[model samples]
Target: MSAEIVVLLVVFVGLLILNVPVAVAIGVSALAMIATLGHVPTAFLMAERMSNGINSFPLLAIPFFVLSGVLMGQGGMARRLMDFAAAMVGRLPGGLAYVNTLSCMLFGAVSGSAAAAVSSIGGFMIPQMKEKGYSKEFAVALTATSATTGLLIPPSNIMIVYAVVSGGVSVAGLFMAGVVPGMLIGFLLMVASAVLMRVGGHSKAGVAQVPRFWPAFFGALPSLLLIFIVLGGILGGVFSPTEASAIAVAYAVVLGGFFYRQLGWADVPKILLIAAKTTSVVMLLIGASQAMSWVLTYENIPQMVSEAMLTLSANPLMVFLLINVLLLLVGTFMDMTPAVLIFTPIFLPVVVELGMHPVHFGIMMIANLCIGLCTPPVGTCLFVGCSVGGTTIARTTLPAIPFFLAMLVGLLLVTYVPWFSMALPGWLNLF
Candidate 1:
């Protein structure tokens, strides 16, 4: 490796080890390497790369989607969706777990964020699960695992990032491709929850014995329409994803403030503030990552990595498996955003070389890394779920094992069965 590369790697690892925020870590490392090597003038390079990173028109979707998710979360749409999911599955064996999974899927469809799913659905369900006789750890495990669906559902900000980073692979096609696999993961998670409930001899007798479904159905209907408006509009070419996000945000605000009468005007500032903070974090990461990617490309790191992988695996299946292993390991330590930004460029050429569709690979990569958001060391959702359940990570992780296995299985299906990710895209003519 070149001296510059060695210095860059050391600075990156040092910043991470010191627990600096990821965006800052990346920026600082890139700046340090550039200064040390004098490869490019620091000020000019930073300005150029940062501008280019956030310059894409598609990136406007990020803040809009984020605001929409926050609006829905604070507006009581998440709770209503949970009620609807509970009504549909609350009578089943381990019904609460199933309800948790289903509710995450529904909320994910609208929010397009796993953290939002956890904060909204999880805050409501974790308490209910405990009240309904589910173990706190199991409840936390279920919520944390289910929250990952956010990355795969429509309006996903991560999908937008992937599209931007991958040099404009179709965002609409990526969105559609995620639907089937996202639902498939939900189904498998629910099944895994059922089996676990049976093994643990948990019963649903503790839940409220509600007989009427109409109220729940009616309450959830409006929120479901938001999904249609955002996703359907995008898929139908009625709106771009950016435009869809704007519409979705408007819908969420109206639903929360007027229709549901849950969120008041007083809540508006807080919602926007939260959304702005989140957007800043994501945008800064994108900016910093762009700088790092610029440096990596200059160093020919992606070419080197791709060539090395091609030498190791001529078979597509082997390449897929190897990538999964690599991602899973990285996911355990890193949050999804930086990981995707860093690795997508490195691995995408490998996928293209193996004759995989970029859309399929994008979906598979997101899903795999989403699993990491629930894993140990830096599992954001796991920590969030535990906070909601008032439990420790150690306590929740044991029950999380089965759910992790279920996610792994789902990942394998999406990775190998390209049809699962491609079918919806094909039908929609999104390719």
Candidate 2:
């Protein structure tokens, strides 16, 4: 490696080790490399790249989606969804566990944020489950693992970010590709939860008393309508992803603030403020990561890395195995958004060269990282789940083992079975 490239890696890794902000670590490291190479003036090039990074029209979706999630979460939507999920699954053996899993899938799909799922679903379900005699560890582990389904489901902010970083690959296609895999993961987690319940002899201990389906369904219908309006419109070609996201904001407001009458004018400003702060962090990370990506590309780092990966194995299965293992480790330390921004550019080329579809690869990357969301060190969902479940990290990790294995199995299924991701997009002829 060139001295300049070595300096970039060293500085970036060093900053991350020192616990600096991810955006600062990326921007400072890139600037240091630019100065070391003595090319263009560091300030001018860095400024140019940073501005250019967030200039895309599609980037607007992040804020709208985030605002919608905040609105839905703060109003009565979470409780309504919980009631609906309970009605749907409450009669089964280990009913509360199924409700927890299904609620996370539903709530996560609507909000497009696993953090929201963990906080919202876990807040209610964990206490209820504990009252029903389930262990605190089991409640937290299941909630944390199931919440990650949001990342794989439609209307996902992470997928929007992936589409932007992959140079305008279809957001619609990526959304289509995620559905089956996301549903599959939800089912696997439910199965694990059911098994855990049977082993603990809690199968019949706390059966939920569900209301009539019609009553609960009608109660939750308004909040549920938001999903159909947004995703159905996108799939039907009625609106672009960004337009759907904008409509989601309006719908969430009307449903939460007006029709439900749960949220008032007083709540609007707080929601907007939170959304703005989150958007700022996400946008800054994108810009900084883009600047670093450009520097690496100019230095031929992507090409070199791609060549090295191919030399490891010409076999497709072995190549993906190695890639999945690498991404799993990467998830341990990095948060999802910055990880996607930084690593997508690096690995996209390698996978495409191996004749893998970018859409499939995007889903694969998100699925692998979903496991990390429940892992320790820096997992956001992990923190939220533990906090809400009233358990410590060490207490939750052991119970989380079975669910994590279920996630790995789902990841492999998505990775190896192209149809798991590709079928919907193909039926829609999206590619």
Candidate 3:
């Protein structure tokens, strides 16, 4: 690496260690690196880059999806979805645990935000699980880990961001690619929950109020329809992902306001304000990340990284393992959005050179980052989950071990077996 690259990397990492906000850290680091170059004006170019970063047509999907998720959470859609999941899995050995896992999968899919899933689904489920005699630590751990499935599922903001960073590879293709792997992770989590439940003797807590399939399914149908409408429209070619997000917003409004009667005119301003604030944070992060990415690219960092990775391993599988390990560590400290922006450019070409598909790599990258959302120091979902469950991170982290392993296993399958992520998209000709 050049002196400039070294300075940028050091400043960024040092700021992170000092607990600086990620967007500010990235923005200042990029600016500092540019200053080191010593010929051009940093302010104007950085301003233009930040503006251009959030300038993509596809990026409009972020705010719409954010609004839709907020509406769905406030409209009582999450509870109904949980009811449906409970009904389907209510009689299993670890019934409520199954419900928790599946509910996160469903809610996360709809919300497209893992933190939202943790808070929305966990806000209800964690209390209910505790009422049903589930261990508090287990409840918090399960909720935090399970909520991560949202990032791997469709209508995911992370996936859209990945698409933008990866040179606009099909958003639909990445969404399709995520379907099986997302479920795989959910299923693994379910199995782990079931086994742990049986071992801990908590299987009977949910039997007293077994949920019926037809009733729960009917109750959740409208909520389920949101998924079908947003995802179906995309898969059926009715709209692009960005267009689908608008439809999502419209549908969420109708569902919350008219159909469900859970929302009212009084709620509009609050929801808009929340959405606007969220959009600003995400867009600024993207802009800062874009500027940092440009600096790194300008330094030929990706080329150097790729060449170094090749030196570490000639075998494709070994190369993948090394990359996965590095990414997992990265995820532990970095949030998914910035990590995706920063690393995708660096690692993508390495994998592409190894004959992996971009869509598959995109999905793999997401799956790995989802784990980070459930980890400590920077795990957004984990923090929210512990707060909901009324527990400490120290206490909750231990119980989360099995779920983390389950995610890693799912990651391994998605990484090595391309079919896990690529099959549906391939069959549907999304690529």
Task: Report the number of the highest-lDDT candidate.
Answer: 2
Clashing pairs in 1: none
Model 1: residues >4 Å from true position, as ranges? 203-206
lDDT (Cα, tens digit) per residue for candidate 3, span 20-128: 9899999999999999998879999899889998899999999999999889888888888888998888787668888888899998998787888888888888888
> Per-residue lDDT for 1-431 in model 2, tens only?
89989999899999999999988999999999988878688899999999999998899989999999998888788888888999998888789999999889989988888999999999999999999999999999999999999788888999999999999889999988998999999999988887888999988854457867898899888877887888789889899888999999999888887888888888778888999999999999999999999999989988988999999988889989998999999999988888899889988999999999999999999999998888999888989998887789998899999999999999999999999999999999899
Please list the C-alpha lDDT of all candidates, in the order they appear. Answer: 0.88, 0.90, 0.89
Worst 10 residues of 3 by lDDT: 203-212
Model 1 Cα lDDT, one tens digit per residue, 262-378: 889899899999999999999999999999899889889999999999899798899899999999999998999999998999999989988999999999999999899999999
Model 2 bad stretches (over 4 Å): none
**Decoy 2 TM-score against native:** 0.98
Better of 1 and 2 by TM-score: 2
| Model 1 local distance difference test score | 0.88
Candidate order, lDDT descending: 2, 3, 1
Question: Model 3 RMSD to the real structure?
Answer: 1.2
